[model samples]
Target: MAEQVQVFGFWESPFSRRVELALKLKGVEYQYFEEDLPHNKSDLLLKYNPIHKKVPVLLHHGKPIAESLVILEYIDDVWKENYPILPHHPHQRALARFWAKFIDDKVVVAVVKAAGSRGEDREKAIKEAREALETLEKEIEKSNKLFGGDDIGFVDIVGTVIAGWIPAIEECFGFQLLTTDNFPNLIKWSDQVVNHSIVNQILPPKTEIVAFMKANWKF
Candidate 1:
């Protein structure tokens, strides 16, 4: 029997998009419910993810899996042979986890700080974010096409989903992180990831995202 899958998510959320992409890539059929978030979170979302009260909750055969990363792991495990999201090797899996955690702990926080604060605080945050981006650039400098070292994998799913906001982050803070010459590897990787069919199908217009971001900021 095919396991029934349902995902509660919001459109503009990168984490939510991550789950959608993973499902599509694996050819898994799922019911998608878009949530309003913060203002009006659904009871199901609360029931599934009581701690965070977040979206991107995947219900597989009525079993709830909260957190996008955790759901990705679950998807990969359930459909490993068909379209493997994670690398089979433990070391490779660790690298993907490291990058994902860096994005969560460091990049997102820096983005929030850079957008809301001013003077030395914002500048310091940008510098810290640059350091994290530089590490990514270095890793991809002389590597294969994807973050997984080849075709799209766990790292590619995580990296691309989050990096969609790089342009918005730069414009929001009046800073330019990606340039023609500087951060070439990251720029190349970003282009490839953004242009992928999986991402292109799911993302909204860039202008809409920009407008949405500008309005959503605390400043």
Candidate 2:
């Protein structure tokens, strides 16, 4: 019965890991199929997500769901009897979604753009990434714990990309962008997220991720 859920994912993808973590937190069992991105994509992945042509696709029973964020929401809604990803309070849930959108529009895309560009384009990308991170830092200074303010919650699960991946970027780039002194709250929040027992199961080893970023991306 539990095997009805299937996950198509890529290694080292923050989005994929987010969905995986959500499933783990909710105690849902699913078959995982790894996909090669921008290269060799699986036939089922092509069939499941003909539009996006991307991984992190979730198949429940026989219905297919694409996009990691969408997949997370689906997982939580499907398994809502146990763990709830979005808050019961509408305002809190909106805040959570807002920050997740912020990360996507600001940090994730900007970092990749910077990593792939050069000269002035790279400089602009870097600046955009830094500003986005500063926003994250300020949020942490206020929240004092997970994004939910107490126990680990939805936004924290989605935002794990920031907690688990950002410092690795600093190390791989040999830069001091996310410094502890400047972002004390963010640093503390990262430590808290990584230390969560469930998060450890979904996040990749820091060393391996750093190496991958160094080889695949510029910074």
Candidate 3:
């Protein structure tokens, strides 16, 4: 029997987009359910991901996978034929996973949490986010066009938020976190990543993202 795949996710979520990109790159056909999030979550979503009660729950032949990064690895492992998400070498694969975790835990999380803060707390969040970005900036400077060299890989997928959501975060918070002067390599990399054929095809419209942020964020 053919595999049954379904994704429960939110449209604005970077996590959801990561799974979507992985599926698209591997040419996997699946059903997509957009969750209401923080208000209403479907029974299926809740059943599959009770621990987090979050979107980006991937159902594969009835087995459930929660967490976007874990789902990405699963997709890559299952498909294994085309558009490999992680590097083939063992050492390189380890490094890819490391950077993916770093971006999620350090950069994306910090910047986003800070974007919603106020006063001195906000300042400290921004400071920590900048420190994380600086670390990533040096990493990107070592590659050409992407963290994985010529093509998108695990780290690249994890770093997608820097391209797609950071702009909206900056707009809503009324400050720029990524700039040509402070992060030239990352800026160039963001441009390339957002414009990559697979990514550009699926990326949500920037204006809509900006409007959504303004509506949802207190800033």
lDDT of every model, 2 decimals: 0.80, 0.82, 0.88
lDDT of model 3 at residue 100?
Answer: 94
Cα lDDT tens digits, model 2, 49-150, are 999888789999999999877887788788888777788888878888898889888888887776667789878988888888889888877868778677
1-219, model 1: which lDDT tens digit per residue? Answer: 235999999988888988998888888888889898647999888998899999889998899999988999999999887688888889888888888777777777777677778899988988887787777778777584778776778877877644587787677668766775878888788788888887778766667777877777657
Q: What digit string (tens of lDDT, one per residue) describes model 3 on residues 1-219?
A: 235999899988889998999899988998888898657888988899999889799999999999999999999999999788899999999999999999999998789779888889888999999999999999888874689888888888889988899888887787778999999999999998899999987789888888877787665
Highest-lDDT candidate: 3
Stretches of candidate 3 above 4 Å error?
1-3
The backbone clash count of each candidate, in order, is: 0, 0, 0
TM-scores for the candidates: 0.93, 0.92, 0.95
Give the local distance difference test score of model 1.
0.80
Q: Is candidate 1 or candidate 2 better by lDDT?
A: 2
Better candidate by TM-score, 2 or 3: 3
Where is model 1 more than 4 Å wrong at Cα? Answer: 1-3
Measured by TM-score, how close is model 1 to the native structure?
A: 0.93
